[model samples]
Structure formats: structure tokens, C-alpha cells
Target: MKRPYKKTDLPVWQVRKFLEPGPIVLVSSHWQGKNNIMAMGWHTVLEFSPSLLGCMITSANHSFDMVRKSGECVINIPTADMIDTIIAIGNSHGPRVNKFTRFGLTPEPAATVKAPLIRECYANIECRLADRRLVDKYNFFIFEVLKAQAATYPAYPKTVHYRGEGVFMVSGKNIAMPEKFRKGNL
Candidate 1:
């Protein structure tokens, strides 16, 4: 079979466009005496059995310095209803803006880390830095999940995913697949 479209030059900046269709999450961290939060989209799973995750925080972000210093953070996943709030959080500077108070966000103490868990989120995953070897070169950090929390009702809440260039997509419809699998997969 032959491919339909001819190959074209791909720009360096658009490299992440294909990989950018991921749920937006808010990363909260604490360092010194401050609690900071940042909206993140560049994260992926490293493992599922033990639940390891990898994230990239640019050097310019305010949460980068705090997460680097404290070595701990909370990944808070919000529903599609909070898309506007997420954009506001991402646009504002964390150092000058008190997101929690300004956005009317409720902060709850995390079980395993100093970072606060956002009560409004659908899920919150507490994490600790697992490796920092690539942070200097790539601004990437490997995190090990310490604890996790999720809401019970509305099991499949709509989640918003970023598609780059001020655009987003929302999760729709839930489907179940019956297939062979391990008994204790969960």
C-alpha cells in the first residue's frame, strides 16, 4: 500500500504538536514557605504497575524552582468544566498571583507530601522526585507516586486535553471492552 500524502518539511517547533493531545494537569509544590501551582500538559507515564510518571517543567516556570528545591509535588487533574480556570492559572504568574485565593481554589493537606491537594480536582496524585539526572539537560523529572485520591461519583468526568495553539479537546463517551487480561491488573 502506498501512502496518500507526500512528505513535507516538518518544523522543529511543531514537533510536539502530535504529542500535545494530553490532559492538562495542575502541578502544586511547596518550597521554603510558599505553595505554588502551575498548569502542566507535558507529562507521560513511565510505568503502570508501580505507577511512575515523567514530567517536563521548563526552567522559566515558577513551579520549576519550587519543585526542584522540595523534590515533591501533587499532580491535580481537573474536569472539562474547569477549562477556563486552567487557562487563567496557566496565564498568571505564580509568584505574584495567589492562585488558591484568587481563583477560589480550596487547598487540602496532602497525605504524603507538603504540597497541597486541590479539593476541586477529580484526582490528585502525590509524587516525589525519583530521578534528576536529565533535569539539567532536558528539564525533565521522573516522579514516583506516593499516594493518590479520586472522586467517586461521575466516574467518567469529562477531561480537557490541550491540542496546542489555544485549542483543546474534551473527553467524550465511555466504552467498555471485554478482553483477556490479568485478574489483578488494578
Candidate 2:
């Protein structure tokens, strides 16, 4: 048996590579009669009650202006089957490419907001801006989830995660923890 082990310092630029595995979500925004969709990978769960979440959208993105003005958006979670479409959607600019038309995606009207939900995605979360304190400095928007919908086959639904630089990975295997969560006092 032969084993090879090596250790080397990772480049500063590659630090993002370690944080790249977060779930990828398609953010759709509509304002002043214009709508756009952008794929993003950097987001985090901020709270449990009211479902607070935070996501970063660069000021350069086409959806940024719309979302900032509207103060609402939909976060659509795509399954592994839509990996190619997800990549295509993220690779092209929204202004030039009508993602719905170019990527063959279906847009369904959302209940609480103008942002359309991608019908092809396995899950959709409607969110409204909860705080705008970090937008100018970090392009981060804090959202309070309004509603959520998910497919029945949530166990191992093969969702994709970004690995940086045109790389992606699909979700696999499900595990259940034994401990039960304690309810927090509101």
C-alpha cells in the first residue's frame, strides 16, 4: 500500500474556494415594470422565527437596482436536474438574455410579491427586505421570508452548490440527527 500526503499554503485568492460550497439560489426581482433574475451562492440563515436570511448582490448585477427599489424578491432553489440551465443563467447577463426565454424556464406569479417564481425549481422562498443597512457598504440585503414552498421529495433532492469558477456539485445523501430542538421563547 502506498500513501501520498502533502501540505501547502493555499493562495489568498483561493480563500473563497473554501466558502464556495454554499447552496446556489436564483434571485428574481421586479420593479418599475422591469424584471431580472440572477444566480447567487453567498447567503446565510440569520434567524429562525420569521425566517430571516441574508444574501449578497453586487451593485453591478442587473437585479440589484430592481431589488433595492422593490425591497422584495424570490429565492428559487434549483434541483440537480437543472444544473445546465443554472450554469447558463449565471453565465449570461440578464439584460442581454431573457433567462426565462433563453434558458427555457417557466415563471409563475408569486403570491406576495411581483417577483416571479421559477416553476422548475424544487423550492421557492418569498422574501421582503427586513433591513438595508449593509447594502451600500457590502451589497448585503437582509430579508424576512414571507412564504416558502418545497417539493415533496425533499430528502436528497439533488440540489446544486457552487464550487467557484464554473464548477458545481449536486447534493447527496441525507442524514437525521437524534437530538430534538428546544423551542425558543418569543
Candidate 3:
């Protein structure tokens, strides 16, 4: 058996460092002939059915208004190899530069949404605004996925997860424990 672990006090705001769900995603938006991409890490899967995703995009961010006005965006999942591009998009201002052109990312026309998809990314999820009840208070947007596509060769992409304070964790080896799960659970 493993030894018991010690616990330490942590600030409330810093709790996200330990509880951030899933990997960072590139949110692409287009409105009034302008396109923008923003790197987002504060997102969570809200439901399996209807494929709901909840993310917080501060009003100060340039892409927030674009996404809000358009009512749609593409959530692109980049591999660990695109860390530089991800950081560049996050650091740069959307109004000043075109991220797709600046970063050399291909923008493919999406099927359901007006926002273009990032072709270089491992996967892309086209989403439509589903709820705005929390946006006014929390800057949170709830999206309903309209379509999703991904590469088939690699079963899992090397995704990057943020741990706050400029720290990131890359996806490592995956373990399949199908036997440990009940039917329809895996």
C-alpha cells in the first residue's frame, strides 16, 4: 500500500491550478469580416449528450466580442508540438494581427458554423452558442457542439494542460482500463 499524502493550504483563486479540466484549446471566431483566434484553458465538458462545453472568455479579450456577435466558434485542439503557436496566439492581440496568417495555421471552412476551423490542429469541434445566462456575470459561455472531426491515425494526441503560474503539463502515456469499467462506461 502507498503511504498517506500530506495536504497543504491553498488560495481559492489558485485552486484552478489543480482542477483545470482537459487541454487548452484554440477558439477561432469570425464576425464582420474579421477573424480571430484565442487560446483558452478555462473550459469544461458540461454534458455528454448535445455535447455541451462551458468556457470563460473574459470580456477584455478581443475574441470574446467576435464570438458573442457571431454566436459560433470553432474549438481547435492543438497537439503538444504547437505549444509555440498556442502561446503566440495567447500573447498577441487579435485586433492587431491575424493569428491564422501570423502562425501559418490553415483555416478550413467548417460545415455547420461560419467560423473557420484550424486545419493543423489534431481535432476541431464546431460549436454554436447554446446559453448566455452566465455570460453577463461570469464571462462564461455555454456552447453546443454541432460537429467534430479528428485525425484517425494517432488514437490520442499529445495535448497540453495549463497549471497556472506559467506552468503546463503535457499529456503522457495513456492507460486503457476497459476491464475495470462496467458495460457502457468505457
Candidate 4:
């Protein structure tokens, strides 16, 4: 009785917009002893064992080139207070402007990767490039999380999610369904 699903052609921009908000990741990469940070909204956990994560960086971004050359990156998860800084970094080009200096963000040496970590962020993950072919065709990069740590946070701290363009939303309230409606309701 269910309607048959149909595939429809859509532009990449449209497809990107249709997807829900994703976690904001501050990706740091180093090359030639110079470091750079880029605000990325497209990232996700790919595996548990060995802690794998996937991220997408536009081919045109300066950070992409650094990652390609260094084969390492740090994924920093910032709290709500960092929304402004994140937006500023995302809106500007790293080659033209040093985001760390412009935003007054500290660049601390990562324990496992050549890239640095955002000191202001609540959490950070040091990763090495596990796969690069994904970037060749889709501008996506896969990383194997080598180490991770967290700063002090409340039981529930507000996190920012990028909605697109210059828009962002904070982590909202939580909801729990009744046991009957949770699973196997039918």
C-alpha cells in the first residue's frame, strides 16, 4: 500500500540545502610550517573502532591544499560562544586573512597531528588522512581519529549547527517519546 519512491534530479546546491543542519567543525591543517583553520559544516563519524571521521572541504579552499600536502587535520567542536568566530572564519579566505590572528583564536599544538587545535573549542579530535580519493571526485576527505579530548562542559552545553549561508542554530531542547511509541509501536 505504500507509494513507490521515485528519484528526482536536483541541483547540488538544492540537495545540500535540503539536508538538515550539521555539526560545525573547525578543521586545522598545516603546510610549510604555516597553519590554517577552516569552518566546516559537512562532517560525520564513519566508524567506531579506530575512530574514523569524514569531512568535506571545497577544492578551492586553501585548507584543502594543506590537508592534501600534510595528510593530517584536527577537528574542533566549538560551543555556542564560538558561533561568531566560526562565521567570520568561514566567510573569509585563509590565504588573504590569517583567521587565527584576525579572530584572536589560539593555535595549540595537537598531540598527534601536525595541524593545531582551536584552544577555545570545547572538544577536539586529531586525525590523519585515512583516504584522499573521496576528495578527488567529491571534495570529501576521510580521516582516522587518532586522539580526542574535551574541555569542561555542563551536562548539556549549547552547540551550534550550521543551517547554510550565514545562518546557524543552537542545540535545542530534547524530547523523549513514550515507551509504546519509542519502537515496535506497530
lDDT of each: 0.90, 0.86, 0.93, 0.85
Tens digits of per-residue lDDT for model 4 on 154-181?
Answer: 6566788876666677887977667658
Q: Which one wins by lDDT: 3 or 4?
A: 3
Clashes in predicted model 1: 0
Please provide TM-scores, in order, for all candidate models, with all chains considered together: 0.90, 0.89, 0.96, 0.83
Instruction: Report the C-alpha lDDT of model 2 over 36-139, residue by residue, as the tens digit.
Output: 78888989999998799999999988888889999999999988788788777777777786788888888899999999999999889999999999999999
Give per-residue CA lDDT, model 1, range 1-186, as digits (tens).
Answer: 977987789887876767785789999888887888889999999998678999999999989899988999999999999998999999988889889988889989999999999999999999999999988899999999999989997888789888788988898987675455566653
Q: Considering only N, C-alpha and C atoms within 3 Å, which residue pairs clash in candidate 1? A: none
Q: What TM-score would you give candidate 2 relative to the actual structure?
A: 0.89
Angstrom error at residue 25, model 2: 0.9
Question: How far out, in Å, is residue 166 in model 2?
Answer: 2.0
The Cα error of candidate 4 at residue 159, in Å, is 1.4
How displaced is residue 155 in candidate 4, in Å? 3.5
Evaluate candidate 3 by giving its C-alpha RMSD to the native, one decimal: 1.1
Location of the lowest summed lDDT over 10 successive residues in candidate 4: 177-186
Residue pairs with colliding backbones in model 3 are none
Q: What lDDT tens digits, residue by residue, belong to model 3 across residues 1-186?
A: 999989899789999888997599999998998889999999998999989999999999998899888999999999999999999999999989988899999999999998999999999999999998998899999999999999996998899999888899999988888899999776
Give the TM-score ranking, best first: 3, 1, 2, 4
